[model samples]
Target: MKPLELYLHIPFCIQKCNYCDFLSAPSCAGERKVYVESLCQKIRSYKDLAKAYHVVSIFVGGGTPSLLLSKQIEQIFEAVRETFVIDSDAEISLEANPGTVTEEKLQAYRNCGINRLSIGLQSAKDRELKRLGRIHTYEEFLWTYELARKAGFLNINVDLMSGIPLQTLVDWEETLHEVARLKPEHISAYSLIVEEGTPFYERYGNGKHLEELPDEETERKMYYRTREILESYGYHRYEISNYARLGYECRHNLGYWNRTEYLGIGTGAASLIREERWNEGEIPEKLDRKAQMEETMFLGLRTMKGVSKAEFAKTYQRTMESVYGKVLEEMQKKGLLLVGEDQVCLTDAGIDVSNYVMSEFLL
Candidate 1:
């Protein structure tokens, strides 16, 4: 059986963030109950496949997975366990919001066998947090982290963002410094992406001059500075946006970067399978090796290790040189990709302009 990871999306939040476009609705206790029931039904429907595969990870993400009642959270895990052959040591993770989690909820998560927690602490500053429509305050995040510890969760990842409106280098530095002081097992810092229909996007279109996002140069400096500071705290860059102490890199996300098969559950989730099937929402038409190649390239660059030459060769039944000779040569000359003995990784410049590089593989 091929390795598998499971991602279940919970689409309930107290309020939708202004910058988020992910499928989520305002938190209603009744709707949450219905959604959980529907999710269980979906799990039961796929029980045969789940039982046939070896599940390596289970990720509960979403609108606000932390908003679930403790009993509801337990029931979800119970359904997954009943329907799937989850490995004994599989990394079961749940994405949580700061204010939504209580000590009881954290303890219930532990009791339900959740081994990892990814806390959404978007900014260390209250003003920026308000701008991003995050519901939690910095103080609330600190409290949540301590409570997670009290609940016996040591492997915790803090989610942060940079390059927001009104953000400056000093703000970035302080945020990094404060979060690192907490000594989380892992940290994921991402740049803000302005999506259509988001308040940021709408405001930009309306000529409402919000604080400017940092220019490209400033963004680059922020990235490098963050990397240097986090490394000083003994965290290594396992992926473009993720840093962790050794062995704490997210396993579920690794499956994605490797282009391995996983099941995506809930509204608006995308998945890749060995045998491509028709899906109308997000997948491109005419799915083929070129499409697969594009996915492999983009997903690879997201990781610090990039792609393994040997794995690419094995997957495509061709040596790396034979498959991408001219492209590799050109990229090397441009200093965008560093070809290694066993792998090919994007250089700093390559990561910054990854979309252009990845587009070439779409042919």
Candidate 2:
């Protein structure tokens, strides 16, 4: 059997953040109960496919998965275990926010085999936290981190953001240092994009927030210095925005960049399996060879290792150079790509303008 990854989406948040546009919203107890029941039904529906592949990772992401009652969390995992053959060392992760998790919930997560916890602490400064519409204070995030460690969760990730409105470069550096002081196993530092339809869009969308937001030079500095600061704290950049200790990289996400087959089960979740892709309500579209090759380059380039030439040739039964030799040569000349003997990857400068670099791979 091949390896597989699972994503269980919990779409209930206590209150949505202003800068957030994920598919989540406030819900009552009855609504949560109904959602959990339906989610478990989806898990059970995959038992047959479970025989064809063993689960290598399970990521329970949300709208604040920590908001669920311990019993509900347990119920969801029970269905997963019964319906899937999980690898012994499979990485089971849950996304959480502060002010929603408790000691009982942490213990229950341990009991339910959740081995990793990703705490969302966008900024370490209270003022910045308030500006983001996050419900918890930095102090509350610290409390949650300590509680999770005390509960024996050895693998923990801290989620952070840079380049938000009213955040200076110094404030971004301090936020990095403050989070690094705790030494999470992994860190995901992302730049804030002004996604449409959120409160941020209303206030700062369509060429707004020029004064409130950092300038272009400051944003560039944030992107460049993140790797330097995190590496000084003993973390390595495994992907463009993800840093981790030697062996603690998030396997579920790696599966995505590596194009491993995965099953995403929940409201509006997507799925890719056996070279066929589909969303929750959409019919599956079989990925043609050219489409597959494009996905292989674009998705794989997100990682530090980039894509492998030998593996590409093996899968497609053609030479990687024959397909994109000119593109590689041009990119290498521009210092935007590194074409090693076995693999090709984006340089630091390339990652800064990755949208343009990746777009060139389209056939």
Candidate 3:
């Protein structure tokens, strides 16, 4: 059986954030209960597919996975265990919101085999949290983090964001300093993109709120400073936006970037099975070899490790030079790419303009 990663989405939240466009909504107790049952059914329905794969990682992300009762979480895991051969050391993670978690609930999660907790603490400033429509304050997050640690969760990830309306360089630096002081196992610092259809878009889209936002130069400074600050605190940048202590990188996400086969369950989730990509409950679109090659370069380049020449040649049965020689030569000349003996990776400047650099790999 092939090794696989699993992601289960819980689409219920106490409240949705202004910048979030994920499928989630405010739900009541009865509604949550109903959703849990449906989610369990969905898990059980994958028995056939489960037989052909051994589960290596399980990430329970969502609207707010921590909002579910311990019993609900256990039920979902029970369904998974019954269907698949889970690795003894599988990384089982749950995404949590600080406002919704308590000591008892966290302890329950630990008992239910959740070895990792990812807390969503977008900003260390209360004002910024409020502005982002997050229900928890910085203090609440601290309390929740302490509770998780008390509950014996050594593997933890804290989410932080940069770039917001009314945010300054000092504010961003302060947030980083405060989070780094806590010394979590991992940190994911992402730049704020004003995606369409969210409340943030209505308020800031189309340069409407540009005045409140830090200028491009300031944002770029914040990005580079994130790496310098986090690395100083013993966190290494394994990926562009992800910093981690040794052996603490998120295996589930690495699977996604490495093009490993994964099964995504629940509303609006997506899955990549072999060379096919599809949303939940839809037919997968099979990708041809050229498309696969393009995806490999684009996704792998997002990491500090970049793409492996040997692995690419082995998989495609052709030299990397045969496919991307010209592109690599052009990018290297521009100082946007580094062609090491074994791997080809993006340079610091390339990472800043990664969208354009990655586009060049498309067939």
| Per-model TM-score on C-alpha atoms | 0.95, 0.99, 0.98
| 1-363 per-residue lDDT for model 1 (tens digits) | 777888888988998887888888896788889989988777777777765588899899998899999999988888888888888899999999998999889989999899999999988999999988989899999999999998899799999999888899889989999999999999999998888887888875454664577877888889999999999999999888999999999999898888767787777666555546333146634557766766777788789888887888887787777767788888888988898887888898887887777665555
Compose the digit string of candidate 2's lDDT tens values, residues 112-172: 9999999999999999999999999999999999999999999999999998889999999
Show how many residue pairs clash in every candidate, following the order shown. 0, 0, 0
Candidate 2 is scored at a TM of 0.99
Which lDDT tens digits does candidate 3 get at residues 333-363? 9999999999999999999999999999998
RMSD of 1: 2.0
Best by lDDT: 2
What TM-score does candidate 3 reach?
0.98
lDDT of 3: 0.92
Residue pairs whose backbone atoms clash in candidate 3: none
* Predicted structure 3: clash tally: 0
Q: lDDT: which is higher, 1 or 3?
A: 3
Compare candidates 1 and 2 on TM-score and give the better one.
2
